[model samples]
Target: MKLLPLARQAEVTNGWLRERLRAVLPEVMRRARVDLWLVVAREYNEDPVLPSLLPAPMMGARRRTMLVFHAPEGGAFEALAIANAGVGLDGFYTPMWDKTMLAEAAEDQWACLRRVVAERNPKRIGVNVSAEIAFADGLSKSEHDALMAALGPELAARCVSAEEVVVGWLSRRLEGEIEAADGINALAHGLIAEAFSPRVVHPGVTTAVEVAWWLRERARSLGLGCWFQPSVSIQRRGEHLGDLGSSPDAVIRRGDLLHCDFGLHYLGLATDTQQNAYVRRLGESGPPAGMVAALAKAKWQQELLAAEMVIGRSGNEVLRAARAAMARAGLEGRIYTHPIGYHGHGAGPMIGRYDNQEGLPGAGELRLQDATLFSFEMFVEHALPEWDGQRIKLATEQCVAFRGGEVHFLGGRQTAWHLI
Candidate 1:
């Protein structure tokens, strides 16, 4: 039931990924009300929707997986791909749609695609073309040119953006995908634990830079992929510091507050986690009182943030509600949660980002739905009356879902600092 890595054939059930994607594609086609659905791609080049529609670790169209769905929905969804790599979409998909053999249009794959379109003659064709959310921008320039040449005079006018349906399909989760996403999201938290423990630090000597590297190496060796580099920092007594873009080299002195923000991508899902750590003052069995309360406040903020999860609320609505709830609790913080599914930060409803609280006009305006995964990236910045006059900072992140109108964490959040 878990969505395992594509290469691990035995670990995953076959056709599961495709089944989920196909089940939703129609909704996309239906919503757009387009006459024909055309997806174009080649080996190395794939349409924005390719991975979801593909047969995993998709090498490319040995037989491509291009597909077209004519309006009126019946019969199998038409598809095309390279010959024999076993796209296995036979009936559902056909081999190359060649109007001319290798002799004509030798350098392009679009020649064959035109044949599929010419036959269907869709009035408003949906292409992966888009103005935002770059993943949906899958078509290549050369392929665009060839498609234009083959379609002739009016083809340009026929195309329109598939952004809405594409975002809905890609960002929205199926029942089965949640099972896979939850199973692997644990890896992200595990990486955080390892980086913060005594095993990776020497207190007075080890620096955040060392822990960051450990995260990268650990993820690589374990076969867990990272969307971006991991970040580790010693919040050693600070007040106002912005996004710590890189791992700081400051020595990890005893009594310093340290933490890491990291995650790994595996199978077809991703996990995001951020945890705080305390470089124990020698012989002090626990974190300083201020640090303990700060971590506690961060956890509470997450709890309050989760309270906003309700079906049918748009990303902006949920975000506004979560922030208000935090403020009501007398908590000081920020939330930058994003939909996490097929991609690291998949295309569902975004809870919040750093600067864009009002939200982008499109994706951010999308509504929240159950059975979808999200990175509950929020923070608590309060004056820890217990720390030195310099003050301190605390932040923690965990993955969760708004399942059936309630928000639940994948594994759980770090309520206390990693004791090293």
Candidate 2:
């Protein structure tokens, strides 16, 4: 599927974003304990926070642009870079680039960065580099080696981790970005509902693979992207994550359960949703007695998982709470949720993986930030004694945001599945 368009590039005014940056910059500096932040990258290499740092007009990274931000003990921050425009840092930065000097100084990126560091003169320097988060691994290995050699041992020793600052910025959602994300999520429901209709899925005709490709093609037709590969499966009687039977070789039969785990990407935002559908027979009124009960119990488990989202709490806290709630309710389920944003699987506050829920160092350590977006992802399986006697697994995903100390669903949660 094709990726959806980015938001229209608009004029940034002296508004909340500017004010928030002013407040956040100093706070980040103090927390990170770094007087200066030197973001060094050649063309095509950018800081994980580069999009947030740059002004609207610059699309791709410019050559040898080193953004420098410093907060002195007595005054406002000093914002400048090796370019004419200072990444909206003009309020606190002094432009230090001259066309004549850059043309004659050297063709080397490392040499230029060293000169700027010597001129700026700050105690501590912070660069984005981390072992846990791939987003922070923007610095190329060769570039890192060159930087250390050119800056000398003393200056190189000043580098510190920018993980906390990166997490704080990425997890904290902006107003415009939230609105766009919400709209994109709502569009996902429409795409799936239409794809599951009889027009695309004819009983005894279309295979699961055919229906899956149709979903991807339909999304491409609507000018959007899929977060991962779209998956479609039919759970007849007995199915498991390990084995879902002989891969839908048989035709779609009456009273069969059609389950799908899919989502679409719109406006640069990715969504994850899973849903179930039942095929009606010649005189059957609705889904079989057993499948409905199993789905109901699964839905109950969904509620238990969603109710635990809290603000200012670590991923580990919410995760433990969800498990406790699940045990109290006597539901068998698994939770594997992650942060979703500008990049899919974005970059903060990971709840728990299906396999590893005991806790992770950097992953589970991040606390929930208000206004942050997350995909409420998990699964529930229940056994039915009423029908032919089998277990059915139900999974659904919806976008939820932590705002004002509470979690609110973006559009709405699916209570019942759409019948095919």
Q: What is the C-alpha lDDT of each candidate?
A: 0.69, 0.69
Tens digits of lDDT, candidate 1, 64-100: 4456655545545544553332444444455563323
What C-alpha lDDT does candidate 2 achieve relative to the native structure? 0.69
Model 1 segments more than 4 A misplaced: 1-14, 42-48, 60-65, 69-71, 74-76, 82-92, 96-109, 153-156, 238-245
TM-score of each: 0.86, 0.84
Backbone clash count, each prediction separately: 10, 2
Which 10-residue window in model 1 sums to the lowest lDDT? Answer: 98-107
Looking at candidate 2, what is the lDDT of residue 252?
71
